[model samples]
Target: MNSCATSFVFLRRSGYAGLLWVLLLSASANTLASPVSGTLSAVGSNTMAGLILRWGEALSQRHPDINLQFQASGSANAPSALITGTTRLGPMSRQMTDTERRAFTQRYGYPPLELKVARDALVVIVHRHNPLAELTRQQVDALFSTTRECGANAAINRWQELPATQDWPFGAIALHGRNSASGTYGLFQQRALCGGEFRPTLSQHPGASAVVAAVGESPGSIGYAGYHHLTPNVKAVSLINAEGQAIALSENSVQSGDYPLSRYLYLYVNAPPEQPLPTAEKALLDLIFSPEGQQIARSAGFVPLSETVRQQQAHW
Candidate 1:
């Protein structure tokens, strides 16, 4: 059998069995052919672009002929690309909406396959010098939204509006956030802003790193970005939980959904019904579902999926 067939057969049986073993064994034993060399391209979430590049680097070490090329436009670009058949892999930070799924189904006569690859959290950050610590949901809504749909009776504009910073010397809170094209923008709008519109004063950025940099530079500024983009120049603010306790971002908290902003990162594939996935895509996914891949996720500052979760999706 060809390398693709061998990988597909093994993956279908083993669920998320690590790809490292298969490649090493095939190379050392010379029983199976090596993975064919070619370029694999993907486009989507800037939040996940770095992680994917890291994975691609690892993949190239094993199959030197295989190269990876991708675009980190925004999560909104992923589904459209998949629909148009421009690319087979679509990495997204948010789940596909009903409309997006419908559009794919209409085009292909089936739904696109969504694979959960990792977990991440959208965190609120302030300049490290800022003494303010925790924020209530109402306060969060008031600070970033024009509609205050999260139930804040009043909008929070200046630093004094928050009781924790009422005596602080800071003036108006400069707001920063992701642009509408980003999945981070949509998720933050849905969860933090309660589906309300952002205030006109909010500075929109193209990527999470940009948002983090802006927050770090401006002493009175506040913004939200993926946890991986965190830096010492900024401090992640804890959110008040339902019990009125402060819940900080941690592996345990985000994994258990204790952190209100926690979310799953996804990779959408244009796998036609009953057809085997393309070799390049399957090999990359095999590595992603492996222990080494999870380690790469941790090193990159994103939470890896647990063993139990991997078992549940073995058929994928």
Candidate 2:
């Protein structure tokens, strides 16, 4: 072949290869870019507020295209916001009720997807100065329930009524707890009170922080809140289980089901199986399950799922 002809062939082949490489690089860049661009709104579950806020902040750093907004309403508000198409995500401290599911299905032609993201134990907290360190589930019931037990245990109105309450000069035992709007209150009622009603005298706070604060400030008082809310001003009191074991609240005990009040924390998504979840919503989910997300949960004083459960949940 002529030298000019050979040079032309080499240039043509090199040009085609370079074009192919450029096309591949472009595709890779597109893949790395944000898939969705829009605001993502989540509402409900004050128990999940701190963790979600942290996740949202991290998400902003990773995907500046997404604008994430959240509201820390009580868990009871999740189903309604989800039904009204007002929120892309809803965090709940409890599983959705059948009524809630039906309402959602009626509105959207499918039930909301429920994801278990974390676990919490409903702990009874008291002022650190209060010497009461433990109580049986039955005792908790008597203290909180209007239908008091046998005569001797009919009421736990006084701090002194509790056995061996040390050196506490007490008046009435002030009671505090989550308000009716809170999922924590519902769970506490079911798990601790055995579905009994809260005594009318029980002071109801709007959120866990308020309950913790109230209990922390009251000398002869106690309140129930998520285990994660434990702070220096207040102390978690151990609960006695059926076998007379004083189960301490911890990630290990809660995950092992040894803690009587341990329960799952959930995120209810408004996605249908036939349709893909919104990209921004899915990204937030990734952040929640990411290693950094789990660390954020730890910082919020909640328990991340155990390794086995976490792996299984990731596949979901």
- Which stretches of candidate 1 lie above 4 Å from their native place? 1-36
| Model 1 alpha-carbon miss at residue 230, Å | 1.0
- Poorest 10 consecutive residues by lDDT, candidate 1: 27-36
Which window of ten consecutive residues has the lowest lDDT sum in model 2? 147-156
58-89 in candidate 1: lDDT tens per residue? 98876777788889888889999999999989
Output the lDDT of residue 289, model 1. Answer: 88
lDDT of 2 by residue, 1-316 (tens): 2764565567568877566556555655664676655798999887788888888888887776678888988788989999998886999888889999999999988778888888888898889988887888778888888864422257687877777584589878889998785677788888788788888988988667888998888788888988877789998889888899999877899987799889888999998877877778888888888778877888888888877877777666
Best by TM-score: 1
lDDT of candidate 2 at residue 51, scale 0 to 100 = 81
The clash numbers for all candidates, in the given order, read: 0, 0
